[model samples]
Target chain A: MKPGTGPLLRVAGVVPGLWLAGFFLLPLAFVWILSFGEKQGLVAVDIVWTADNYLRALDPLYLGILAKSLWIAALTTVICLATGLPVALGIVFAPPRWRPLLLLLVILPFWTNLLIRTYALIAVLRTRGHVNATLGWASELFGLPFEPLSLLYTNTAVVAGLVYVHLPFMVLPLYATLHRLDRSLVEAAADLGAGHLRVCITIILPLAVPGIVSGSLLVFVPALGSYLTPDLLGGPDSQMIANVIERQFKSANDWPFGSALSFLLMYVTFGALALRSLSVRRPAAR
Target chain B: MTEAVRVGGICKRFGAVTALAEVSLRIEAGEFFALLGPSGCGKSTLLRIMAGLEHPDQGSVFIDGIDVGRTPANRRPVNMVFQSYALFPHMSVRSNVAYGLRVTGTGRAEAHERAEAALGLVRLTGYGERMPHQLSGGESQRVALARALVKRPRVLLLDEPLSALDARLRDEMRLELVTLQKTVGITFIIVTHDQEEALSMADRVAVMETGRIRQVAPPAELYEAPADRFVATFIGQVNLFPATIGADGTAQAHPFPGVTARARGIGAGRQVWIAVRPEKITMAPRGGVPAGRLSGVVEEVVYRGDLSVYLVRCMAGPDGLVRVSRANAARTADRLPGPGTEVVLDWAEDCAVVLAS
Candidate 1:
């Protein structure tokens, strides 16, 4: 006879479930309660319930940071998808022996620390860096005078950094999905008079939506809350919402306001993911 | 009638393995043909070559007298039903059936109308809105058939179409497929490993082994006059006895001391094998051995509901069992002889076929 799932599952789930409730849910509940309180002196909280923190977070100055963050994250996601989709497809369709090596190359960057990798990008992008030095040498060899271009410390550099870091997040899911696609379905479509473009549009693209949704969520959520890349690479005008939140907690000593801002980001991210999952589920149900 | 598909001197190799070796065959415009072989025998490869899914390394394929060796699969006049059915999981039944028409730029209304007609022909008219995953295995196969037939292709290729279904559904679909083919009146080519499917459904079958065609014949001729030892044994169960031909045009083999059967196409003193089907041999009571009969002892009896199979140990043969099958026509207590009983077996002289390979 089989063991009953009731008591056995409850016994097995006790440790991890209690661990999550204690360390994760308890802190989140405290943060929610703290968002409504007032901040007193440094590291002190006063129990005066008010809506002032949320009101201040809705100001045009803070809202603009949020919008800018969304724009940058959206752009980064688009660029990653445009580049990652082809790379993922290539890996899935590559010769059997070369596939593992190519996948390893995609993941090799993760072995290094992300902060260290971003700092290394500065050497390639700075004026008189590797790129400018190469361009200057090529111009001089051609007997043409050239000036070193300022490639770092700009919005472009920030976007490039975000895209570089998030590209693998987009590629891995797409590879998993495309690899699971049946090759016979493509052959059947071709046998039914669909050319290569039609096969991609009608079959491959629609079937790959789950992967695209997952990859977009993976890239977008982290990008929206990112602070390091913008601070290290962007100009003062390119500040995002996360930079503001960081300043509120560390420099301004405003714990309640920072908590309120964090909740807002969480709510918006949750709403977007919920909407995406709903859209994905409807077609599958039909 | 003009040939619908003609493959000439085709050869295909996959790295180190040769899939097809200078293979060639012609299919008529409306005939049901089958390529029958075991796994790795290159029947599927030849079917793919005809569908333009795989290209031959040498020679050419002509559909309706137009050389299609350079044509891509989408542009070819042939379509295939894959082994897995390959239905689009996301699409509705209507959309799946209409996919071919829509891809070729047919108008939306026309494509839908033709798709509905195709569905009705397959008796799944009310299942248009259902997803592919909602259908059973047999329904999925019919939808695949409807999808291919909507294109009205010059030739239809089925790669093990019914291999995935249960036994009852496979038998039903076999008849349905034959009726569908006749109603549509287009050429159909199927690849299968089941000898029974090939013999029962195809108007003609090409038996293949090691990338070469052993024989191509109708069902009756293929069973009655196999070309060599492979076709003789591959088509059905046969009892083979190693023997030699005498100068008097007679075969001398074990269990039959005197020269009993005559064979053609062999010189005297040449080695050969005589083949006879199990059902062709008649079993009688003990001590009933006639002048040309062989005697044996029944070692095992397998009683199927419809027939009884007896494994007999031949007293004079080279230490092998000769099987005999008898139909259970009447329900009687002692209709079949029990095991360990002595029996005499004899077959008509013309029933034995001599193979010299």
Candidate 2:
């Protein structure tokens, strides 16, 4: 509305507009176009517009893998929420001088490469890892028979690795929400004859809905598309959707099918986002 | 009267800062008591200790003649209306008010009915279904009061309940709060820094400073007499000058060689404060025997609607200024004394109190 500011605002928006168009929109369009094409020959895709690739993605074997990936991602999201909520609360209620240190510890994992962290998980969960060795020592101390339990190359390892890598995503959002909360509301509840558990259930949890939703989505979306963690820590039976997509592009030489699977994952992400928006609207409508 | 809340020697420390230092207080049953002080004077800390929200490092809190020092806030028979009101934004007004009853396992129908009755008490009968965001500041304050009162607490604690309202609404709520307290017939303990609010609503006010109680008295007594200089200046406007007492019950100041005022204390050569309210001093045209009067030039005249204040520059007074206020009781031609007018300020023999310096 200011003089000559319309053109000036348009000029300022050009930088991010160009970057998003070039990096995100172009790649997404390419994959979308590839999804409707067919594999004509080895190492090439034909531009014959058809739904064959989409149909092949909906087959029983691929559907089974998608369902398994959803179960794993859902389990990972639940675990992250349960663990991250308490951690965020602890950081929020800690002494003012110690808050920065606790937040730094939560975020320090980001400085390390994900591949290295996943590899570290591999080192920790393998047959002769720290946990099994500790259990062996405890059994010896108790004078009982000792057997090293198999902790590596299972679906459990994949879930464990996913929780570890994605925990900070959950904690950061929950912390941001709970920190901005008016603590006096909790005090008022306690003053009105509500004890600790009642306050947590009636006041804290209901107020933390937005944080819980966003944290779950952040963990679930990335966890569904996880590749390196499952590759390093999961067994053959624990193949997720991302691993299947990789095999379609690499081992099977089928770019069209891989693009179709990628678009399917994008649809799931959109669905989750729609749920979040619906929840936000529900409170506003009230 | 029977005691409702008695906190004895309550002590609390936040890290290195001593927030409360052996504070003690007593509130009679069904009496409206106010802990009045400036911010960070340990009034709110003492209130929290009595509410069981903060544990005292050392002390005992007895409510209704029973020791409740170890009880938690939720277990105590007291509830607080927070300064921010602390209304649950996610709940409707009815749900918020009914929360206390429902939490203690009361039936939903009965809780709803009692909540409605409490809302009616605050004259918010139809606003139960509305969320907290839909209410105004004054409305939210009433809802908070209703929510706390619905539980029928033995004592209600209000932490600056009207501090968030506009000036007009604050005045309105002050009278309403007193009426509601009397109607309920429960002990009420209020914490506030506003002297006018405390003096107007509370039956007894405890003035605090620097983690200690300065004095506790009724409004009239606190205004007419103060225990020390802190209480003297904190409550209302006063003219203060240091003076030494003589054996003849007359106080003498050093600036003017022969000026004297009567003081009832029995000590001689003791340094004390000569405290007189601004309204107690009378200013007239400078032409009298200068025995007990100090002559000065009028520095400024502040014209309020109901009263006028005269600031006189007197060499014989501490800080070189003496303040006198005259009420505008009737229309008069000479009420406006412009600056630079010469005036004589004098008070009656017993108008001032000699307090320990």
Best by TM-score: 2
CAPRI docking class of candidate 1: high
lDDT tens string, model 1, B252-289? 88555732568876898988888888899888877745
Worst 10 residues of 1 chain B by lDDT: B252-261
Off by over 4 Å in 1: A1-23, A130-149, B258-260, B316-319
Q: Which candidate is the best by DockQ?
A: 2
- In model 2, residue pairs whose N, Cα or C atoms come closer than 3 Å (at least 3 residues apart or on different chains), thus clashing, are none
lDDT of 2 by residue, B226-315 (tens): 888999999999877778888886888757543466777548888877888989987787766463467788998888869998899987
- Chain A TM-score of each candidate structure, as shown: 0.92, 0.96
Evaluated on chain B only, candidate 1 has a TM-score of 0.96
A1-286: candidate 2 lDDT, tens digit per residue: 9899999999999999999999999999999999998898897788788999889989999999999999999999999999999999999989989999999999999999999998888888888998888899999999999988888999999999999999999999999999989999989999998998899899999999999999999999999999988998999999899999999889998999999999998898788889989998999887
User: What is the C-alpha lDDT profile of model 1 across A212-241, one tens digit per residue?
Assistant: 999988999999899999999888898888
